[model samples]
Target: MRVSIDSATCQGHGRCYDLAPDLFGEDEEGYAVLTELTADRDVPEGREGDARLAAANCPELAVLVHEQVRA
Candidate 1:
């Protein structure tokens, strides 16, 4: 899976980072940061659903989750 964060819509809520620190981070202003742009493997063992939940929970809906299909 791939994650994208829209800086414009972000309000520095830090919910994403809080939910999945390894997958998401926060800038100085607390905006969500996409920790991994490309992944060779699946979402971390226990973080799959958590990450999705975090994105959905964003107040501004700034987080986006995409499933990458390999050939």
Candidate 2:
């Protein structure tokens, strides 16, 4: 899976970082920033759930995880 944040839609609610710091954080301006595990990168195995949860918990729905379709 792939993780990405729509910075334009972020409200800086901190839910992404608060809910999944391992996969998310804040930039100097306090906007949501994806971590190394998923910062403009692919999701590690077993951590897609966390990414999805973070996206779901985001009130602004700025977090997004593109699920891979296994053939």
Candidate with maximal TM-score: 2
Task: For residues 8-68, write the lDDT of model 1, one tens digit per residue.
Answer: 8999988888877877788787777766521433466557687688888888998887766
Candidate with best lDDT: 2
Candidate 2 — number of clashing residue pairs?
A: 0
Candidate 2 structure quality by residue, lDDT tens digits, 1-71: 98899989998999989988989989998999888877666888898888889989999989988999877
lDDT, candidate 2, at 50:
86
Segments in model 2 whose C-alpha atoms lie over 4 Å from true places: none
The CA-based lDDT of model 1 is what?
0.74
Name the weakest run of 10 consecutive residues (lDDT summed) in model 2.
34-43
Q: After TM-score superposition, what is the CA distance of residue 2 in candidate 2 from its true location, in Å?
A: 0.8
